[model samples]
Structures are given as C-alpha cells and as structure tokens.
Target chain A: MPKLFRKVREIRNFLRSFRCSNDNSNSIGFVPTMGYLHKGHRELIRRSKLQNDLTVVSIYVNPLQFGPGEDYETYPRDLERDLTVCEEEGVDVVFAPTDDEMYPEKPTIKIEIPGLTDVLEGAYRPGHFSGVATVVLKLFNIIQPDRAYFGEKDFQQLKVVQRLVKDLSIPIEIVPVPTVREEDGLAASSRNTYLKEEERQAATVIYRSLLLAQKLFSSGTRNAKDIKEAVLRALLSEKLVSKVDYVEIVDEEFRIRDDQVMEGDRLLVALRVGKVRLIDNWRFGDEAV
Target chain B: MPKLFRKVREIRNFLRSFRCSNDNSNSIGFVPTMGYLHKGHRELIRRSKLQNDLTVVSIYVNPLQFGPGEDYETYPRDLERDLTVCEEEGVDVVFAPTDDEMYPEKPTIKIEIPGLTDVLEGAYRPGHFSGVATVVLKLFNIIQPDRAYFGEKDFQQLKVVQRLVKDLSIPIEIVPVPTVREEDGLAASSRNTYLKEEERQAATVIYRSLLLAQKLFSSGTRNAKDIKEAVLRALLSEKLVSKVDYVEIVDEEFRIRDDQVMEGDRLLVALRVGKVRLIDNWRFGDEAV
Candidate 1:
C-alpha cells in the first residue's frame, strides 16, 4: 500500500527519510492529478513507475485553476477510488491535500506564460493557465521529483508546463504521456462523469471530428482554415453539442496556424455537449498525407 | 581561488558534482548580487558562509527588474573586483551568467505577487518585483540552495522573495540579513556610484530620516501619519534630494499603516538625490518604543 500524506511538511519529511535510507532510489517520478482517476491517470502512473524507483501521485482538484463560474464546486472527485487505483498500480506514495491545506491563506504569488496563456482555452477561461502554472510550480517544488508526468490530452497545459520548467531552469524532466481514450472516441477525463447517457454518446463527436480533420489533412487539405472549418462543422453537426467553443489549428508551441497546417501541427477543439465541455486534439504528422 | 561558472548549466553541473563528492556538505547557501560588491553584499556572503557547508554567490544584473528609463544599462559592473571579493571571502562557487545565457529567448514566463508588488518600489518600477521574483526563482531552481540570503536594505524586495518562496513552497530558506550602512549612515548600494559628490553626502538623509522616525517612535509617537510626515519632511528638506518618491509606514507583511503604528511596523522611504534613487527602512521594535 502506498503511504498517504495530507500535509506538505509530512510528505517532505517522508521523502527526506526515504532518500536517506534508500541510496539506490536515485530517481523519483511524480504524476499530479485531480482525482477520479481513470485509464489516463493509470497510464501516467505506469510511465512514472517504469522510469523511476518511487512514484507519487497527487490527487488535487485545484480551485485556483477554476474561474468564478466554472466547475470548481462540481468537479468530480473520488479519493477512495483514486487511492485504490494507486494501490493497485504499485504506486509508492500519494499526496492528497484539502483546499484549506493547499491554500492556508489567499495566495498572492501568480505565474503566467503571457502569449501562450492568452489563446484557445485561455482566451475562453481567463486566469486559468496562470492558476495551473502557479499550482504546478508549487507542486513541483514541494515534491522535488526527478521526473514529472503530464498527459498530452492537455496539449496547451503540457506546453505551458514545459515552458515554465524551461524558463525557470527547473531540473525535473517533464514526460508527456500519450492521451488515453475510451473504447469509443471520447478522451478519458474525470469530467466525463458529468455527461448524461446520450451526452456521453455525443461526446464521441469531439474525437470523431478530430479524425475527420485528420482524414482531410491526409487527403491533401493543408490549409488550416479548411481543416478548422471542417472540424468545427462536424462538432456543430452533433445535435447534443450545446455549444461549439473553439476549433483551432496550432503547432506544438500553441501558436495558432492561420494560413497553413504543416506536419506536426495540431487540430484542437473544445465544445459543450449538454453543459459538459469536452476537448480533443489530433496531430497532423500522425497520419500520412 | 573560488571556482567561477559563467553559465547556468556549468554551475548546475558543478553543484551536482560538489554534492556527490562531499557527504557532509548538506547545506548550500546562496547570495545573489549584481556585481560591484559592497559591504551589504559582503555581510550577506558572510552570513551564508557561517551557516552552510558551501556558498554560491551569483552576480548578474537582471534586466527584467529594470523598467523603462531605469538603471539596467548603466548599472555598475566590475567583475575583476567582484571576483577578488569572492575569493577573499572564501566563496565556494560564483555563478555569473550573461544576458544571452540567463535569458536565451524572450522570457514569456512572468511571476507576480499582486498586493505587495503593486506598491512602493513595485509601484514606481512597474514589473520590477515580477522580474525580481522570476529571476530569483530561476536562480533558486538552478542552484537548489538550501538557504538564500537577502539584505533588508531592499525591504520590499526581501519581502517579495520571501513570499515567492513561501507561496511556491520552494524548499530553500530565505535568510534576511540586516541592512549594512556606511560610517555616515547611507545604506550601502551599488547605485550609490550614480550619486555625485554632494549627492552622496545628501543620501545620508534617507537613513537619518529613518532614525528620526525611530526617535519619534521611541518618544511615544505612534501615529503612522506623523512618522511619514516627519520622514517626508526630512527627505524633502535636503537640497540635493531632487524628488521624494514615497514615505510610508507598513508592517512586516507590507500592509500600509494609515493611522496607528505599532511594534514591528516599518517606515520605508524612497527618494532621488541627483539622478540616483535610494531606499531605506527602519523597524520600530529595534528601539524602546
């Protein structure tokens, strides 16, 4: 069973002791999550376990990342289930802290990557990337892991984290695991629980639309406008998709591709299916044109 | 002779090797400076050497902290003198990277502490504290020092750095050393070089005004207004003081004290003598009142 730590100091103490006694345990791998663990989290955990001697998974639905009217209150959480998953996956430790514990008082410090944070999901949700960067940096400092895992599902988030580490000269290696998906096409996410039975079926459109764009790209549609238009049209075609938030084509750096979509450029989309917002992305190079 | 590393990667590599070879060298203390070492920096270096097994002194004038028309271009520099000081003081390593090295690209990542950064030095020098926090954090990550020393002469900067570490949960201890002064009471500063002959003499009024406030506090004066007024009066009365920027009373956490001044409250002042700006602070508890 993995040892659980609720307080920051206790975990530091535990890691210190663990380091002191285990000379052979030179590397530690960390996976930060927001609980309600699924195969996506399991993949991250597996990647971490394979790479390092000890693995720590933090289950925290960071309130900082949620904007005023967003899903801070209603974000799905299941600690018991998350803990069981960690135990079953042969994890070494788990850090699960309360809101008050994570934020003893109002946090004054903020971290932001300006241009990258001002587009796409960031444009839709103000202060979201800053909050994510702040909390991720905090967790990285607290855990001091040799390597940390972040899924490519949050392509923008992954890019922001990478920028934070590079700009700050942080020593940890950031490993981006492939996004895990259900047998159908919807991306594995804790928020998937919020979808109704039919909405869940509708949610598959997010991935299907990405495939549509990929098929178009593979068949010689390199103009970003055409690919984005095609993806947006497919997402809006789904009746249960209450609103289509954004359909954008961008390179690995999150720079929006306005005219042309080259190899490795990604088609990312976000839309709401009956009040639940789902997002998915497809890389251009994945399929030959 | 102390080892010199002009690159971030080299210093990090040196530290990694130092840590591996030295079993008892558990603590690494750091003092970050901007070259042209003075008594203030010497005191900080001394404190680090006394407390830790190894000492790393970084001397880089961060361009990010200087605003438009501020002293980024003309900031004092004497690498030969600084290296001699480090050598004489027995510093273990010196990390002094160039602008191109420290910031290879346009730094998009910005760190800000809202309330504290929106006042005083932060107010006058826009984006100053954010720049300071960003570079300081970058240095902390690169060096991974156990404790970092900062002088109280830069009271607001010291507070901002402390907040950065506390809020981010960076494992380094922020050691605050007392403000060092010249025989006549002017705070030791690299910017002092900017002051002309008479301007240097006039600069003493900054510390003297702090003493005036302390004398009043010692004489049972408890109103922040009275203290600020007295300090401001002293600063403005000096003929060479071209501009009196600010004279305000704030507590340790930087909350502005409007009415009553209590124990541990600080009287922080900033003013320009000639083309040079100087800042000084005095804590109330240091005196009987």
Candidate 2:
C-alpha cells in the first residue's frame, strides 16, 4: 500500500525523511496530476519509476488552473481508485492535498511568460497558464525531485514548464512522456469521463486530425499554414466537433511556425465535441499520432 | 579563501559537490546582494556565518530589477573589494555571475505579489519588486540553502520574500537581520557612495525621522497618520532632503495601517538626499528605532 498524505506539511516531512534515508540514489521522480488516474497517468508513473530510485505522485485538482465556469467543480476525483492505481504502479508516495492545504492563503505571486503565455490556449483561456505555472512551481518546490515527469499531451503546458525551469535555473530535469491514448486514438483525460458515449467516440477526431497533420508532414508537405489548414478541415469535418478552438503548427518551443515544418515540430489542435473541450498534440517524429 | 563561481552551471555543480560531502551539517545560509559591499551586507553575512555551518553570498547586479532610467548602468560594483569583504566575513562561497552569465537568455517567468507589490517602494519604482522577487527566487533555487538571510533595511522586500517563500512552500527559512547604520545614524547603502559631502551630512535626517516616529509611537501615539506626518515633517525640515518619497506605517506584511501602531508594526520611510535615494524602517518594539 502506498502511503497517502493529505496535508502539505505531513507530506513534506514524509518526503524529507525518505530523502534523508535514501542517500544511495536520491533520484526522486515526481508525476503531478489532478487525480482520476488513467492509462496516460500510469504511463507517466511507469516512466518515473524506471528513471528514478523513488517515484512520488501528486493528485490535486488545482482550482487555480481552472478559469471561471471551466469544470473545476465537476473535475473527476476518486481517491480510493487513485490510491489503488498508485499502489499497483509501485508509487513511493501519493500526495493528495485539499484546496486549503495547497493554498493556505490567497495566492499573491503570479508566474507568467508574456509572448508564449498570451497565445493559443492562453488566448482562449485567459490566466490559465499563470495558474498552471504557479501550481507547478509550488509542486516542484515541495517535491524537490531530481527529475519531474510531464506528459506531452498538454504541449503548451510542457513548454511553459520547460521554459520556466530553464529561465529560472531550477535544478531539476523535466522528462516529457508521449501522450497515451485509447485504442481508437482518443487522448486519455479525466474530462473524457464527462463525455457522453457518442461524444467519447467522436473525440477520436481530435487525435485523428493530429495524425493527418503528421502524415502530411511526413509526406513532404513542408508548409506550416497548409498543415494547420488541413488539420482545421479534418477537425471541422467531424459532425460531433462543435467548435474548432485552434489548429496550430508550432516548433518545439510552442512558437507558431510560419515557415516549413521541421522534424521535431509539433501539431496541436483543440476542439469541442458535444460541448466537452478536448485538446491533443503530436511531435513530427513520434510514432504516428 | 571563498570559492568564486561566475557561471550558473559551475556554481551549481560546486555547491552540489559541497552539499553531498557535507551532509552531516547541511545548514547552508545564503546572503544575496548586488555587490558594492557595505556594513549592512556584511551584517547579513556575519549573521549567516554565525547561524549556519556554511555561508554562501551571491553578488549579481540583476538588470531585471531595474526599470528604464534607473541606476542599473551606473550601479556601483567593485569585485575585488567585495571579495575581500566576503573573505573577512568568513563566507564559504561567493557566487558572482556577470550579466551574461546570470541572464543567458531573456527571462520569461516573473514572481510578484499583487497588493503587497503595488505600494511603498513598489509604487515608486515600477517593476522593481517583481525584478527583486524573480532574481531572489532564481538565486534561492540555485543555492537551496537551509536558511537565507535578508536585511531589515529593505523591509518591504523582506516581507515580499517571506510571502513568496511561504506561498510557494519553499522549504528554506528566511532569516532577517536588522538594518546596519552609521555612527551619524544614516542607514548604510551602496548608493551612499554617490552622495555629495553636504547631501551625506543631510542624509542623517532619514534615520532621525524614523527615530522621531519611534519616540512618538513609544509615547502612546498610535494614529498612523500622526506618526507619518511627524516623520514627514522631520524629513522636510532637512534642507538637503530634496524630496520625500513616502512615509508609511504598516503591519509586518506591508499592509498600510489606518489605525494605531502596535507591537510588530513597521514604520517605513523613503526619501531623496540630492540625487541619492535612501530608505529606512523601524519596528515598533525595536529599541530607539
């Protein structure tokens, strides 16, 4: 059974004790999540376990990250099931702090990157990245992991964290794990549970468009605008995708590429399938999206 | 001889090596400054040395903290004299990175407190605290010291750092040393070197006013407005005190107090003596300011 900590202080003390005794290999690997574990989260846990001597998982549905009317209240959380998943995955510790524990006082410090933050997801969901950046930094400080793991599914978020760590000179390596998807290619997300049966099935179109963009890029289609247009067309073609929020081809740094798509570029898409917002992305060289 | 590190990566490696070897006593104390060593900085270093097994001092003239038309270009710096001061204070290591070394790339992530940041010195120097907060966080991440020392002279900055560390759950403790002053009662500062002989003589008014406020507060005068007015009057009485920036009485957290000055309250003042800007503060319970 994995030890469960609901208080920040308790978990910090527990982690410190573990850190002190585990001097032989202090490579602490951390995977921060918002609970409701799925195959995507398991993949991150597995990667952390393999790369580090100790693996710690944090499950907090950060209210700060969700904007007004953005499903914060409806976010899926099953502590029992999440604990079971952690134990099965051989997680060293499971930190599940409440809203109060995470934010004892109203947070005054805001972490943001200007140009990178004010576009794409940030453009649609204002102040969303600031919340993510702030909470991620707090988690990093609390865990003080040797290396932290983040899935590439949230491509912009991953870029934000990478830039934040690099710009701030935080002494931790951020390991990016490829997104895990269903057999039908729908990206694994707790929000997927909110999707009606038909909407869930239709959600595969999000990934399908990404795969199409990747395929086009692989087949000598170099223009970023053309790739984005093709992705937009594919996404809009789906009857269930009610709205195409954005379809962009960006380089590794999340900067929207105006010219040719390189080997390491990213194709990111976000859309609404029956009112459920979904996002997916794929790197150019990754095994088919 | 204290180890000098100009590169972030090299200093990080050297610090890590020292941290690994000196595991028994990991009480690393840090004092971060912008060079031009003074009695105030020396006081912080000495306190760090007295309290911790190892004391590390960083001297980087952070450009981010200075806004347009500020004194960043003219900021005084003397590395040789600073090195001698650190050596004299028994500093274990001195991390002094150049502008290029510290800011290898443009920084994107900024740390700032909302209400606390918009008043006092923050109001006078726009983006100053944000710059201060950002650099302090970066240095804190790099050093990862057990206890970090800050002087009470920059009282608002101390409060901001305290709030940041607490809000972020940064495990390191913040130790505040009292402001060091000259025999004439003027607060010590690097900018003091820029003062003309006459302006230097008149600079003592900044401290005298604080002492006057302290005397009044001790004599059962609690009205914040009254205390502020008296302090302002004392400052304006000095001919060389060209301008009075602000005089405020607030709690330890820097919230402006409308009522009486009680225990743990802070009375802060900032004024200009000719071209030189000076600041000073006194806690209610401190002896004679």
Candidate 3:
C-alpha cells in the first residue's frame, strides 16, 4: 500500500527523512489527478513509476479549478477504488488532503500566465487556469519532485503548466504523456463517467473532430480556418452535442492560428453532450512536438 | 573569492552535484540581495552563515520590483565591492544574474496576495509585492535552499514573502533578521544612498516615531489612531521630510487595526525625504514574536 498523507508538513518531513535514507532513489516523480481513476491516469502513473525511483500520486478534486454551475460538487470521487488502482500501480506515496488541509485559509495567493491562459479553455472558464497554476505550483513545492507527469489530455492545461514552470523557474521537469483513448477514440477522462451510454457514444465525435483536423492538415490543408470549419462541422454533425464550446487552433505556445496552420500547431475542441463537457486536442502534422 | 553563478541552470546543477558530495554540510542558506551590500545585508548573511553549512548571497537588482518612474535605473550596483563583502563574510556562492539573465522575457507569471498586498507598501507602490513575490519565488526554486533570510527593514516585503511561502507552500523557511540601524536610529537601506546630507538627517524621524509608538503602548495607550497621529506628527516635524505615505498599524497577519493595537502587532511606516522612499516597522511590545 502507498503511504498516505493528509497534511503538508508531515509529508515534507517524510520526504526529507526519505532523502537521507540510502533506499531513496533520490528521484521523486509525481502525477497529480482529480481522482476517479481511469486509463489516462494509469498511463500517467505508469510513466512516472518507470522513469523515477519513487512515484507519488496526488488525488485532489481542486474546487478552485471549477467555476459557478460547474461540476465541482458532483465530481466523481471513490478514494477506496482510487487507492486500489495506486496500489496496483505500485505508487510509493499518495497525498490525499482534505479541503481544510489543502486550504486552511481562503487562499490569497494567485498565479497567472497572462496571454497563454486567457484563451480557449481559459476564455470559457475564467479563473480556471489561475486556480490550476496556483494549486499545481503549491503541489510542486510540497512534493519537491524531480519530475512531474501531466497528461496531454488537458492540452491547454499541460501548456499552462509547462509555461508556469518555465516562467517561474520551477525546478521540476514536466513529463507530458500522450492522451489515452478508448477503442472508438474517445479520450479517457474522469468526466466521461458523467455521460450516459448514448452520450458516451456521442463523445467519440470530440476525438473524431481532432482526427479530422489532423487528416485535413495531412492532406495539404495548411489553412487553420479550413481545418477549424471542418472540425466544427464534424462536431455539429453529432446531433447530441449540445454545445460546441470552442474549436481553436493554436501553436505550441497557445498563439491563436486563424489562417496558416503549421506543423506542431494543435487543434483543440470542447463540446457538451447531454450536459457532460468533453475536450480533446490533436497536434498538426505527422509527429508530436 | 566566493564562487559566482549568473545562470539559473548552472547554479541548480552546481547545487545538485554539491548535494551528492560527502563534503557538503547537507544544508544551504540563501540571502538574496540587490548588491551594494549594507550593514543590514551583512547581518542577514552573518545569520545565514551561522545557521547553515553553506551560504549563498544573490546580488541581482530585480527590475520587476520597481514600478514605472521608480528607482530601477538608479538603484545601486557595485558588484566589485559587493563581491568583496561576500568574500569577507565567508559566503559560499554568489548568484548574480544580469537583467537579461534573470528576466529573459517579460514575465507572465504573477504572484499576488490580494487583500494583504493592496495595502501598506503595496498600495504606495503598485505591483511591487507581485514583482517581489515573482522574483523571490523564481530564485527560491532556482536555488532550492534549506532556509532563506530576509531583513525586517523591508517589513512589508518580509511579511509578503512569509505570506507567499505560506500560501504557495514553497518549502523554504523564511528567517527574518532584525532591522539593522545606523547610529542615529534610521533603518539601514540601499535607498538611503540616494539621500542628501540634510535629507539623511531628517529620515531619523521615521525610527523615532516607531520608538514613540512603543513608548506610548508601554505607557497604556492602545488606540491605533492616537499612535498613528503621534507618529505622523513626529515625521512631519522634520522640515526636510517630503511626504508621509502611510503610518499603518496592523496585526501579525497584516489585518489593519485603527482602534486598539495589541502586543505583537506592528506599526509600519513609509515616508520620503527628498527623492528616496524609506520604510520601517516596530512591534508594539518588547520580546518579539
């Protein structure tokens, strides 16, 4: 069983002591999650466990990341089953802090990446990336991991985290794992659980739109407008998709690409199917940057 | 001569290699400065040297902390003499990056403590603490020290750093050294270099007012308004004193107090004599908390 921690001080003390011991491989790799463990989380955990001496996973459904009318209160959480998955994956430690433990006081601290986080998902969910950056930075400090893992599933989030570490000189290396998918190409997400069987089938259209952007890009379509329109058309084709939140084409740096789409640019999509929002992205060209 | 580093990657690598060596004392103490080492900085370095196995003094004038029309261009920089001070003080290393090195690009990451920062020195100098917090946090991560020292001369800066660390869980212990004063009781500062002969003499009133606050509190006065009025009167008595920015009394957490000031509560003041701005603070009662 992975060692469980609720308080920040106790785990810091533990990591310090662990560092002094000969058994400590001296490298801690972290994977932060919002629980309700799924295949995407497993891939992140598996990668961390492979690359580092010790792997620690954080299970936090951060309320700060959710906005008004968002599913923060109803975010799926089953700690017992999540712990089972961690134990199966041989995680070294698990930090599962209570709300009081994580935020003893109403937080006054805010971390923002101005231009990078103000578009796409950031545009849709104001203060969402700020909250994500704040909590992620806090976790990075608390864990003091040599390298941390983030899934490409949250592409904008991954970019935000990467830029955050780069801009702030955070010492941890961020390892980006590819988005895991089901047989029909639906991105594996904890939010996927919220979808009904029919809604789940409709959700695959999100990934299909991403692939459609890739297919268009591959077939001599360099114009972001042409790709975006095609992707949006595909999403709208799915009658159940209640809302097409955004179909954005941004370079690796989240610079909006409206006309010419170059290699390494990503097409990100967000759509709601039967009240469940699903988001996915695909890099332009053949290989991922 | 203390070893010098101008790059973040270089210092981080050095610290890592040093950590693995048996010769390392297994502890690092950091004192970040703006060069032109003064007695207050010397005291901070002295305390760091005494408490840890190694001491690092970073001598970079962070441009971010200076607002438009403020003292960024004119702030003191005498690296040759500053290095001499570090060598004499038995410092282990000096990480002094140039402006381009410290901020290669315009910073996007901002760390803000909203309610706490929007008052005191924060109010007078907008985006000041945000800049301070951003740079300090970046340096802290770059130099992963066991402990970092701050001077109470910049009382609000110290508090801001403390709150920043607490809020972000930065895993660094902020050790605040007492404000080192000159023979006339004025707080030691780099900005004092800008003061002319008569202006220098007038600045002593800032500290005198602090002492007066202590005396008034000791003699059974708890009213913050009365103490603030007395301090303001004393500051205004100096003919050369230009402006009284603020004379604030706040509890330990920077909750402003207008009525009753209790023990451990601090009286923070900011004033200008000539073109230079100076700030100082005093705890209401003796036996500091």
Window of ten residues with lowest summed lDDT in model 3 chain B: B16-25
Predicted candidate 1 versus true structure: per-residue lDDT over A108-192, tens digit per residue: 7777777788888998998999889878988998898989999989999999999998888898999998889898867899999
List the DockQ of the predictions in order.
0.68, 0.63, 0.60
Instruction: Write model 2 residue lDDT over B155-270, tens digit each, in one string.
Output: 89998999988878898899988888999988889999999899999888887888888889778898999989999999999998889888888886677898877888988888
TM-score of 3: 0.94
Q: Could you tell me every candidate's TM-score relative to the true structure?
A: 0.96, 0.94, 0.94
Candidate 2 deviant stretches above 4 angstroms = A20-24, A285-289, B20-25, B259-263
Model 3 CA lDDT for position A137: 84
lDDT tens digits by residue: candidate 2, A12-100: 77666566554524678999999999999999999999998889999999888889989999898899999999999999899888888
The Cα RMSD of model 1 versus the native structure comes to 2.1
Cα lDDT of candidate 2 equals: 0.87
Q: What is the TM-score of chain A alone in each candidate?
A: 0.97, 0.96, 0.96
Considering summed lDDT, which 10 consecutive residues are worst modelled in model 2 chain B? B17-26
After aligning candidate 3 to the native by TM-score, how far in Å is the CA of B31 from where it should be? 1.1
Chain B, per-candidate TM-score: 0.97, 0.96, 0.96
